[model samples]
Target chain A: MCSMKVVVCVKQIPDPAGNLRLDQASHNLVREGKLILDESDSYGVEMGLQLAEQAGGGEVTLVSMAPNSETSGLRTALAMGAANAILVSDPALGGTDALGTAKILAAAIKRAEPDLILAATESSDGYTGTVPVQVAELLGLPSVTFSKKVTVAGDKVIVERQTELGYDEVEVGLPALVTVTAGVVEPRYPSFKGIMAAKSKPVEELSVADLGLDTSEVGTAGSRQQVVSVVPAEARSAGEIVTDDGEGFQHILAYLERIKVI
Target chain B: MTLNVIWVVVDRTGDKVATVSLELLSKARQLATTVEAVTWGDPSQIAEVVGAHGAQTMHSVGDLGGGLPGPAVGAAIADQVRSGSSPDAIFIPQTYNGRDIAGRLSARLDRPVLTNIVDVEESGSGLITEHAIFGGTEVLRASFTAAGPGLFVIRAKSFAAEPGTDGAATTDNWNVPDLASTGAAKIISSHVEESEGPKLDEAPVVVSGGRGLGDAASYQLIENVAKLLKGAAGASRAIVDAGWVPYSHQVGQTGKTVKPTVYIACGISGATQHMVGMKNSKNIIAINKDQEAPIFSIADLGIVGDVKKVLPQLIEALEKRN
Candidate 1:
């Protein structure tokens, strides 16, 4: 068995391209219906699988916290070749902010005892972009964010972290946390055999108590920030629509000139 | 009661400050009674610019070598808070390093971080922040319930950078604490992605392509039009994920957020993910065959036609004028 153990954090979010509904009473996303693995987390899962493969022989474990004991998203990651999954589901997790979510994930990660941790830079739904770093901090491990490329050597992990202009080559020792950006790798589709195997793949379920987290500290009661109000963005007034009758390009040119962009 | 706010500055190559840092400094000045600028590297390099941007004091953490010094920088700032010089709030850019620092600081202080904020305003001696959610379809206003030291990681171009007439800022050295585990992560080497044209985020004009272009070869139409207009070429997340273009060209919620003067969308259906990046552009022009495409919802000028035909005609029109 390979000594390298990796834990990848995956999230289940409402399909961005689908029609979404919100809970009227609490003003929260209605996440109980038809949730799938977030597209953003696919890159991290792919990176984890690739790194595990590169390490000669290792297992890729997935960790997630969703409402209603959702195993569909975790199973999807397992179908992509993860060895096992751990899900933290409880009503107390409802309305938990990014920091609270991080605390729970950090505790679960400690139980997995992986040498490396991988996560997406941001979630499709929440998009907080702070949880991975928060997990790293809570676990007291070195962390790197926005990695476009990652490779593992004997006891050291090297990554090309994306910067505003380009990328910086960063090297970190084992037991480090890294967040991957989208398009970092081409995610693979699960095969028939892999899908079949995923059904039997070990999925360990835990709750706030199992993770040694207090309900008061893991839910809305523990949230530091509160949404005061939410409003729809100002609808963009429809503009001129020109049919392409040979003068279409001319109209565009004139518009650009009017805006002084040409 | 005067509020003390700290704004983190990111230094670009050749010692210039990032535009987002200056923007934060400008906004922070208006929100707080005193705005202090924190940065790594030599203080003299950015002291004048930061001061002009409304910073009264400049805190320098010296240098922590080549690789990113996120842990060390965060530790230094946390030390300042622990020493009883705690500021009421701290603002950090949404860059990679900025997020790292914010995360580390939040962990150290056991505080919550309000991230991806686009606006902030003072309310009753505290601050309220606004964030775009659901791919910019809705806006949410949030505030801290507990006392702060509220930490925020703000997006670029959310607020325009305006320099004030303030004089040079007073400089002070901050003692960077020893990093126990964070020191292990070091930079081996660095490489900048090679591109000949203007950057997507900085370009005044941007021409972006989407999956509707059909194939990779058709993407050249976008590049050609961008070159003719002296703009930069961009891509939708769909095309970028499909490997039709580099990730640097992606413009969306997950990609670079651009607010160019003029943005041209070619055959893009304008998914919420893609619209979030360029919705703030001064003028948006979309060319797609689909009349019901969402791109037209926010576009200033919409052309209902095939991109394959319209792009060439538009290119010819520009060429003839030149």
Candidate 2:
């Protein structure tokens, strides 16, 4: 019923549609060239903005931990009407696992002091799906994840938490954390005017030290898990290829019979 | 020399256990001296089922009266570990609520969770987890360096479910600790999406569509073919993210993993994300306009043609035969 301050965690990942490479030496993803907002996080940004708007008047802040102070992705969310952004970038943060990232985010989000924090259920790049909950725990807040639908009512936030078979309508108090599944909402494209306005938006930059996190607690050293090895998935060799060739359907039928699918 | 592992079973309806629970139990038995289970349901009802799948002790936390039981369950497990019954590791199936409990428990125990694990094997002094990252392009191996009670959230269908000779398990009532915030998030209502025919993961035959279906309306062709074959309809992450299909129908890394007898992909240039989910199917048939589509690589049979043209023919031929 009142103004609600929201924070959304966004990620700048290599475009999922493009080719991705791995740093063979470090056994990490090679982050290079242009980085864009992860498609999955767009829903979180949209949800945060909408929740803020519904509360009559509020601000949606973006928080991210990325390499090279990636603002391109945050700008896209800012263009969609977020008030501002906070990016914590450092080379020391490289090779950090999900838990380390959560520690950094938890500290940054605490500074924002939002009524709610929203994040994607998982990142398209890491696909860890653990940081949001970890952040909630670190802040001593309740969290509901895999929310397909979310609504703010009075002091409680209600969500339709997605499950394997269906969904459960869960209600949590304000200042809680929620990780949304994709398709929760249709993310709006930045209008020309909105894009122009985003250029003037404030983006606060911070380092791991600024968050009061020791360098040892926020990077590969702080990571609880170690990547023992990185190997390309066994390539599935090409199988029998058939052109339309008039008899293609019959060939498929015979193949189906061989597999006993019929 | 022996490891004690606890497997958390998600039993929402109080009747049936999730398939992934049994799958984890099967794998847990191999890596642990004792495979204990925790569930939020009547222990008597699920004891035999879990025991048949290798669980030795069942810690049951009966229904939480329409509340999300994550915090309560996590607290109960933490209490067990704190009271000198700490297990070597805790394995949880990667589900909505499972992550919630794992996160809460990890924070309570001050340990980190290794999530999205697709495979696990016994390693030197511990277990190693295999993660498929970057849309399943790379496989990374990791293990915990911490002490006991390493938490893991495992993916579905990662291991085969097998029944053990034991037909019953010793059950104990787990007392849920009263917490100020455990009751904060309450489940007012729940609904299962109305699906016709068989479920996607259990369906013997699955017909899936992707972005190449062009628009949402064209998705009907995928359904029609699936209907003709008495199979379930599925979709790739591309189509699901595009809002063409519900998340329940999505078959990929972030979605449900289906190992159907036959998986037919239409208009899908399978990304590694989509392939990992259904690549384990007994037979894969991919139909896409592009010959070099990644889907064709894993497909037992590949049709390099327009799906709009080919799907109609396949349906018509199946109808005639029927």
Candidate 3:
């Protein structure tokens, strides 16, 4: 059986470091600044590499859609052993949410006819794990989501789905999608040899037009959804710490009982 | 009359309804006597159940899974907007499925959707709903000025539903056709993972482990306690990143945000990601060998003791109570 072609859908977003920020007028994460590949997306990249390696001979392509600096994240993927990388960056592709991002990525996957699509279960800042499922929906591909472990048998992709309570064993036909969890595989550090080789690998930068995606169908315009506003959640008041000192503890217990904590 | 909107019950799966469906049914009856309910999946005889909940007549969409996301339950309500008799607000449990339904419905119906509301009260123009945000750090109230229906999603356990609320009408048949072609998406199949413990989102007691648990085997201490109490178990992203817990068990900014009544942290050093998840728990207990651990910042009870030693005692106490 031929090895499967895997595409890891990655997103470059604002670094979560100063995540709690208020823009002057918009009260949003100001976009005129630092952005990086979402950290969880690295797990998706790592899973793609592992799957490709286990299959003997195949390619793992890291694909992203955003402004041009998004390619930096692709380099991180390249460092991790992705066979090739692609960045769909253009002013037109800016501010795309999960649905819009998926539309662009689905188009990119169709170009290579990948057997499997991998993505992180969630983004660090946006915190919405909605993209992978939405993309699978658009591509009409079956999805085994929140997957902690993944395997392949012929053309079937088997995975263990991570859920709120436990895990499930599921197998879907190839040309499927999986949103990877941290349990899937530990991402490899950029080895010196891999870093040298990554330079030789292909990283073709493309614009929204190259994917045959109506750029209007991308970004805020393409998004059927929008975060109407972003505000730092209200601050928490300092709580009164209580000690279990007999009578003093009784007061604490009364307070706890009032809040029904005990 | 608080508009007493009675919602029809539909099973989440393609088959029979669940107990939570009845819970929603009872709550919907309490919401209003007008009883405009939307029932998806096996809508037959739902009106009978709806009628018993004080519904004037239940609104039902039949044989729903013709090919739709499970959240079509919300879209059906949106698409079947009625003649001056639609609900002023729509309420749903803030489940993963429920949130999606509320989001999609809010988008399609052009209403404001507020999630994780614990209660609703009468306000100046409409209703004010309360939500727990920034973990459990703050409680906030919001009211919509929009004229149409306001959408709300609450946890299933947030309100207790009493049965046989005398005036409930029988489950009525509502056939909503518009949901069939509203979106270009459909769920061919959905296989859920089998998890131990109570449904994490709805659980009252939750115990979490973190990187300090040291190894995967060490998680058994947390799991043992969870099993004894049949409560949910959680993990910090550090532990999830360290490979001790699956991402699904992760409680943090990038993972599931839960508000259990009692949440216990064992060996977890509270990171921002971790705090965002369990911050809303009514009570928090932290057991870390490190007295300097950040988990103590949010813990109502802090024990500067080894979790490996402390967990066994906690499990025994809970088991002894049983």
Pick by lDDT: 1 or 3, better one? 1
lDDT of 1 by residue, A69-184 (tens): 98888888999999999999998999888889999999999999999999999998778888998899889898988888898988888888887667888999889999988888
Tens-digit lDDT track of model 2 for A11-67: 999987888877878777888988999989999999998998888879999999997
- Model 3: per-residue lDDT, tens digit, A1-262? 3676999888777776554443545323455565666888888888887788787779898877767545666676788889887777788865565556666777777787898889886666555455565566556565656667788878776676543335556666677777776656778888988878877888777878888878776665654433333334554332444332223323323443566544
What is the two-chain DockQ of model 3? 0.13
TM-score of chain B of 2: 0.94
Indicate whether candidate 1 or candidate 2 has the larger lDDT: 1
Clashing residue pairs, backbone N/CA/C < 3 A, model 1? none
CAPRI quality level assigned to candidate 1 from its DockQ score: medium
RMSD of each: 1.7, 1.8, 6.1
How many collisions per candidate? 0, 0, 27
Point out the worst 10-residue segment of candidate 3 chain B by lDDT: B179-188
Cα deviation of B252, candidate 2, in Å = 0.3
State the TM-score, rounded to 2 decimals, of chain A in model 2: 0.96
- List runs of model 2 lying over 4 Å from the truth: B1-14, B134-137
lDDT per residue (tens digit) for residues B81-185 in model 1: 999888888998887778888888888888888988999887887888998876677888888998858998888889989988889889998998877786568
lDDT of 3 at A65: 71
- Count steric clashes of candidate 1: 0
> Candidate 2: which docking quality band?
medium
DockQ of each: 0.73, 0.66, 0.13
Q: What tens-digit string does per-residue lDDT give for candidate 3 at B1-322?
A: 4664534433353343444455565666655565455555555545555455444555555554434333455556765654455666676654444544554555445444555565666655456666543343544555554467766666444555555745544454544445322333333345555687686666787888987777899899888877765688888888878877666677766566667877877788776667866776777767677766767777777766667666666656556656
